[model samples]
Every structure is written in structure tokens, then in C-alpha cells.
Target: MTMLPIQTTATAPVATPVATSTGDPALPLELLELELSLDGFSGDEASFAEAVRQAADQVGGDFLFDLPASGLAEDCLRIAALRVPKGENGAPTIVFALLDAEGATIRVENPDETTKDLKRFADAFVDVLQRI
Candidate 1:
């Protein structure tokens, strides 16, 4: 399997703020900040699951696919997994999703502690998003 390298920067946090497309100017506009890494699987849920497993191994982090609570399904338009490693200060949890036939998206949550390494992880996630 081919893997891509992601790098994060301190100046810019790994977040993509998207606005809702609802055309209600009077209502408060909501913004969602998503920090994700993305890749392409073989357009199959099973393939995506395997990719997540490999990514976990490569990152030395625990991997989970189609977590029940995540509401991912084979028939759904898209599906993904949020991989959370073990230990108190382990790697940030990542959410890997199949955006479409040609691409997948991985989102990473902030670590419990605000450390430089965590920041780098966030940056890496951002880099992944950009590449995707």
C-alpha cells in the first residue's frame, strides 16, 4: 500500500471552517472547523476499512473501522472511522471517511494536552486535507 506523508505548521492550525449553505441571512451563520486527513481507497467499504487498519499500523496508533456509533454503512453515500490510539498522551484520534470514488478524508481531533507534537499532528491532518 502506498502512504502519503503529512506535515503540520504551528502558524496555521489544521482546521477547515465551512459555512452552512442555508440561505438564511437573518439566522446566525454556523461554521464547522474540521481537521482531517484524506486518501483514496478502492471505492469499497472493505477496502477503506483495510486502509484505515494499515494507516493505524503505520502511525503506531490503534485503528477502528465502521464504529457503530459513527453511523457508517456500506450503502451510505460516505463512511469513515475515527482512530483513537491508546494511552493518555497517544496520537490524536483520526476520522477516515470515503468522500467519493476517487478520494477519502481523515479528520483528527485535538489531543488532551496542547503540546508541540499534538500541534504537528493537527498540521499533518491539515496537510492531508489539502492533498485530498
Candidate 2:
């Protein structure tokens, strides 16, 4: 596994999660911040996912290619990536997605909602996203 180092500056304290109008999960502050940090490397969900997958394929290493939810938009499928942390203050994990570039699906997953698959793909090239 390749480890990408993340250094962050202090921000406002995280608030409690509230239900959204559509009843979809509300994004946590951590996930939101992660998305903001990766803005340059991100774009339309479908395009970003395809690019990441292709980049990983070119390197030809282990990549986790499972989608977390069923009924998710097929075009947007590959672009979504997430990582659930094991505890508070653990390596910052990300729940990344782009719905019409609106970020409607980025949120922490419930235990029942999670799949037996990785939340994101990993490779050394991921460093480019981090350093930028």
C-alpha cells in the first residue's frame, strides 16, 4: 500500500451531522475539507474516476475498484472514492464524489451501508494529487 502524507492547517471545529432535505447523508467537515484540498485533481465525477483508473492501470498495481453503493450513477461510478478512518485523529480519510460537480454523495458511510470493499484506490501516483 502506498501512503500519501497529508498536512493540514487548523480550521473551525467540526459540527454535528444534520439530516439533509433529501434525506441523503450530510457530509462531515473532514470529508468536505478533503474534497477542497483535492480540488485541482478533481473534476466531473465520471472524468476524474476514469483518469484515476487509467493512471492506476498504467502503473499496473493493486487497485480497489468497487463502488460503495448500488444504484449509483454509472457515469459517475468510477470517479467516486472514499476512505473511512479507524478512529478520531487517525490519518484523515476522504469521501470524494462529484455529482454534476455538486458533491451530493460525499459522506461518511453507515456500517450497514458500507461494502466489503475499499473506499478508495491507492498508488504512488496519488502523491501528485497530494503535493499539488
Candidate 3:
């Protein structure tokens, strides 16, 4: 299966630590999220997410695979910002999520309110697949 690249003129994704009141804080969740309506893809949403998880791992990405029995759809993938190095900007990149299907969406830990980061990520992921 070939995936077509999508171009977006949006801002970049940034990661920030989530404030915690307790001693043990949960993992940081992405701040910026973008929705995508893709064409020419028909499959189960969970399967799509698993494929992404595998692809990300193949590309040396720090990804968290979703549990098959979790029955969760939104936070399916938690990955590192590939284009941007982790802890490059002083703050550690938080775990990000990507959900793809006929309609897809990407979530990242960024303060910017633009789709640029998501666009870059999507492009990068496609580029990796093309190379492999």
C-alpha cells in the first residue's frame, strides 16, 4: 500500500511538561491536536493505529503501542518528535498520539495553535516509509 503525502502550512510542534500536584505525575500528553480527513483508506481504526505503531518503531521512533483490548481510539500512539530531537529545546518532548483512518488526527505536545507541526510529522513519517 502506498501512502500519499499531504502538505500543510502549519506551525511546528513543541513539547512541554505537564504540571502535577502529586508526587508521582502521569505522563505528559500532547497539547496541540489536528484532525485530518483522508481519502482512499478502508480499514479498522485500531488496525490503522497498529500499523502506525509498527511503522514508527521501524523508523526508530519512541512509540507506545496501544493495547488490543483497551478499546481506546484517541490516544492510540505516543511517539517522540522525530523531526525535533528530544530535549533539544531544554524541555523533554512529551508523548504524542496519532490516529489514522478515513478520517485521521494527530496530537502533539505543543504550545502553538497551528497544523504545521502535524503536517511536518505526517510528511516525515511518509518519507521514512518511502525510504524503507
In angstroms, the error of model 3 at 83 is 12
* Off by more than 4 A, model 2: 1-26, 40-47, 50-63, 66-70, 73-79, 84-87, 91-96, 99-132
TM-scores for every candidate against the unseen true structure? 0.33, 0.31, 0.28
Better of 2 and 3 by lDDT: 2
Please, what is the whole-model Cα lDDT of each candidate in the order they appear? 0.37, 0.36, 0.34
RMSD of each predicted structure: 15.7, 12.5, 14.2
Candidate 1: residue pairs that collide: 8-123, 36-106, 36-107, 37-106
Worst window of 10 by summed lDDT in candidate 1 = 24-33
| Cα lDDT tens digits for candidate 1, 79-106 | 4344444334654444333333323333
lDDT of 2 by residue, 43-92 (tens): 44445555434433333222234343344433233334444342355553
- Best by the lDDT measure: 1
By TM-score, the better pick of 1 and 2 is 1
> Candidate 3 residues 4-103, lDDT tens each?
3345332422222232213223322212111111112233454556544443454335443333312233334323233222333434232334342222
Error of 1 at 51 (Å): 1.1
Question: Which residues of candidate 1, in runs, are more than 4 Å off?
Answer: 1-43, 67-76, 85-88, 91-98, 101-132
**Model 3 poorest 10 in a row by lDDT:** 32-41
Prediction 1 global C-alpha lDDT: 0.37
